[model samples]
Target: MADPLSVSANVAGLIGLANEVGKIPVNYASNVKSAHEDAHCLQKELTALCHVLEQMRSLLREEKLQGTRFEETAALVSVLGFTNHQVNELYKKLDKLSIQANKNKLADFWERIRWPLKKDECDKAMEEMRRLAQYFQFSLTAANRLDFLSQTK
Candidate 1:
């Protein structure tokens, strides 16, 4: 069985990364004109993902799964761990496109004017994120209805 506290920590980390990625679209929007619609779509996806994560975090806290050792708990933890990895990778990919505030004004201006992600890449990322968010939400709902402690015995 997975430790609930540790799983909660993973959820927290993913939430933070999601928030960081969400901010990128907004920041980039100020400088990039061509990607306005894409940025808005990405932002909405991130916001939805973040909302799901926050709900999961609250579920973890309210349920206090520490004393229960069950198969379902393990499965939930697995999903969380995998989602954490995916979100981290997405953050890295998006972060690379971010312009640093300390960079040369001209360089910053140019970087901001250009959106680095190709259309396919943006679509793929958004699709994957949407899928993961829905999966996590399903897992959370299942977790709430199941009795893990009895199953372990």
Candidate 2:
């Protein structure tokens, strides 16, 4: 497993890249092409960084680390201009979905729903919301809910 410090450093690097990408000028004359290219590259790097963060988070969970890195990652992402309100809202929706998905009584209701249609509906509802949902899923699955709740500070 990678060192936790190294993982944190990588996440910080990605956050820096995202900041750089945000600073690219939209109307620069001579440097427009290069700026666009750099922005694209940074976007790719950010995506990869998100994946790495997920892996590191999983490792942290498996090791039973008393401290969590999810909130730290979320804070970094939020600091990068991802709105906290949006993240919280998405999490609420996901909590509802998880409840709906796991409910025994809802099993019959889910079954009675049309297959692709229901899926498409759910997908549409979840569109632009998967990132937060996935983040929450990772955090919840890796650690106990009480542990996670206690770390909210």
Candidates in order have lDDT scores of 0.76, 0.41
lDDT, candidate 2, 1-153, per-residue tens: 344454455545544443333233222212333333333332343344345445544544455553534344454345323523433342343233223344576674443231222345334433433454465346545556566778996
> Clashes per prediction?
0, 0
User: How much does each candidate deviate from the true structure in C-alpha RMSD?
Assistant: 4.0, 17.9
Candidate 2 colliding pairs: none
Candidate 1 per-residue lDDT, tens place, 1-153, comes to: 545566667788889988998998887786566665777788789889999999887776665566655354476777777777877777776775675765488876666667667788889888988998898888777875685755877
State how far residue 56 of model 2 sits from its true place (Å).
Answer: 9.9
Candidate 2 minimal-lDDT segment of 10 residues? 21-30
Off by over 4 Å in 2: 25-153
Instruction: Score candidate 2 by TM-score against the native.
Output: 0.27
Error of 2 at 42 (Å): 12
